[model samples]
Target: MFTLAIVGRPNVGKSTLFNRLVGKRLALVDDQPGVTRDLREGAARLGDLKFTVIDTAGLEEATDDSLQGRMRRLTERAVDMADAALFVIDARMGVTPSDQIFADILRRKGHPVLLAANKAEGRAGEAGMFEAYGLGLGDVIGLSAEHGEGMADLAAALRPLIEAKPEDPEEEAEADVEIDEDDLGEEADWAPTVRRPLKIAVVGRPNAGKSTLINQIIGDDRLLTGPEAGITRDSIALNFEWGGVPTRLFDTAGMRKRAKITEKLEKLSVSDGLRAVKFAEVIVILLDTDIPFEQQDLRIADLAEREGRAVVVAVNKWDLEENRQEKLAMLKEQFERLLPQLRGAPLVTVSAKTGRGMDRLQEAILRAHATWNRRIPTAALNRWLMGMLEQHPPPAPQGKRIKMRYITQVKTRPPGFVVMCSHPDLVPESYSRYLVNGLRVDFDMPGTPIRLHLRGQSDANPYKNKKRAEPSRLRKHLSGRKPD
Candidate 1:
């Protein structure tokens, strides 16, 4: 679908207008200026025309040119991405110099421009509506963006340009795959389809350079990467071939802890990142290297393991460090200590700024992928279980010794196992962890969640068989006495 970007100075009713146009409260609307700090994109439909509508950073001037300049850069990128620009100006405030400045920039781009004079509900707006013509953009749309009045006029004004490209309902439906995502069932993850293009997710805490690393990997500024934290709001998946292996790469939002996610959009973004990890075969947990193992970092790593994904540790911003080798050793040591579940999993150091060690990063991902898909045979698993049991037998509970008979590989692609025995419930969680760790060490499965299940086959009931033999015993005794 094509895109239409909403751009204007602060408090010009951009969010209100965005909420109205998208028919959903996807963007937060408040009377405060500069409430929106990030570029928000949503799907919008006008009549038969379906397109992506982009809501941009509200233009604001900061003293000493703080992050506002960076915001302007992001907005500029939005303008470039859009096929058309929606320039909104307040009718009450009349035309500002900032409006003219933005208009000139959009004009040079030679893209279609639609000027809307918002808050024109009263007769007071007539003069301002007429004055919009002086801004040199023709046919200004005058309507109350908040009340949804004059939307038809707004649509009519922009219809000619977009109506020519009306979307097919089928195409529109396919573009928006509103999957529950939880519905993705347990199937062979290493099937030919998944192997054809490995799904790689770059996950980390905020300002960990997730977007920067993605930009480097794809070798395109396809993702919006800036020095400011939380520049990326959506978990964007792009298809490409990496190192001759077809791959679907996902660049996720810089994940902050649940407490830190104050906004609804950010919360959605973090959930989306989690979903990406669930679908991805290999996950690159990008650590900022500066603060090696924060609570949030462990939370992310634990999440990947829970999802049963192959994990690779990536230490970014290596160039910024003073003692490279020492820092790397410390970082790797922390990774090993804090994230022992991913033991022997690859640790790659890359400077997203300079693209150093990106090749090693990819190499590590493939190796982890292979480890995640490793399948152990039933015989090997049973042997390993025997050794494990001999080393540390299951303790008796209340004078009843628990028996573990045998184990077998139930499945693979995150290898799951089933141990059949008596008193399965008596097996403690610690012992289960011991078995899982032993399997990891012996079978070469690393950075994946090995699921183990226990089944108790109540040893055949001696009383039931004894009752059945009672009648046969009398007949046997009579026949033996007659023979004597």
Candidate 2:
């Protein structure tokens, strides 16, 4: 996917536009200056077009040895990396001195920059939209990301950049066959198709020792390690083997909390980290053992679960800790509180600097991967499910009981189960949590998202011999009955 970096001065609605384009609240939005310090990237879909959108640090005048200088350097890097830049400007404020400064930077880099005069939806922005032209950066597209008035224009502006590459031969061949007609039907008979090793992305907050961890994993300084925060500006993927498993290891920038992060490249770095999370089968979230479980740590883990990616939590800088057992217990408690969805996810303590527990981390990952890939036979799953219902019944809704009659393991790349019942929609989220816990306990699946889809029955079991079973059940009952 082509990289589109959103660059602009502070308070220019760049994050708003980013959220609009990505169709998610991935970035924090506020009417405040420098709210976004780090770069945030997302795989954006403008209708049918998919491209990577980078939300950059707000461009500002630099004061050397200051935070603003750091932000400028980061913004400069984003411009250099970007194939195109969405040069956002506040239409209500008109063209400011900062806009010219950023425009000059964009021009010097020679990247295609789309001048977006955001907040131009209403009458208030007309003059400012007009003034935006004074920056001399081509046509300014009047857009209101908050109002969502000119998204079509934004899409049109982004089309050429997104649609530049032709489809691959393999993709064309696959496309030739209608996807619906080519349905191989439940990949139930499919074996683990191993062409290459799974890509593993190790990501966390800054100074979480992401680079140190990767260096330890590969036994070399494949990535530069430093005490300074935000040292890594790019998400670097290194190829390696773990326990003889071929793998592509991606070491990503430490994700700062939204408030603290203040660089365009850091935003891009975080976005790239997310892409890796989406693309990879498993994601390892590293934490500093000293501060083992931050809110951001849990959020990263939550992202993996939400994306259906297997998660492994690694607590780095473990060697420095004095009371290892107490800290470990506290961290696990926090993990339980924050990320219940990924219950029993392997939490390994490691020192990326010393290489201690690196093997254990690899083992934990392998375990999580296996758990993620596990499949339960329908017969076994249904039998276990029946026992579960008998032990802990689902709550009734409106005096009508909900029957969870049958369950099937429809898929395994994350192990999805479909439950047939009397009322699928009536299933409470709390009870759904119960079923998930039951699935984890009964089937030995942990450290991965176990999806239980509810469908109303009279939703007959898709995998069962419904036509033959009902008549047989009746006949067996009749045969066992006493003379009346």
lDDT of 2 by residue, 187-251 (tens): 11111224356668888888888877888888865455566787665555555566678766777
Q: How many residue pairs clash in each candidate at the backbone level?
A: 0, 13
TM-score of each: 0.73, 0.57
For residues 1-484, write the lDDT of model 1, one tens digit per residue: 5789998898889878887877765555667577565666666766665567778887655433466776777777888889889999999889888888878877888988899999999888888888899988888899787898778887777677776666767655554443221112211112133245677889999899997898799887666666778776656656667877877677787888787688766776677678778888888999987887899989998888888888898889988989998887888788789888777778888999999998898888888888777777778777888888899988887787778888988777677889987888887888888888888878877667788999987877768756444446568687774332
**How well does model 2 score by local distance difference test?**
0.77
**lDDT winner:** 1
lDDT of every predicted structure (CA atoms): 0.78, 0.77
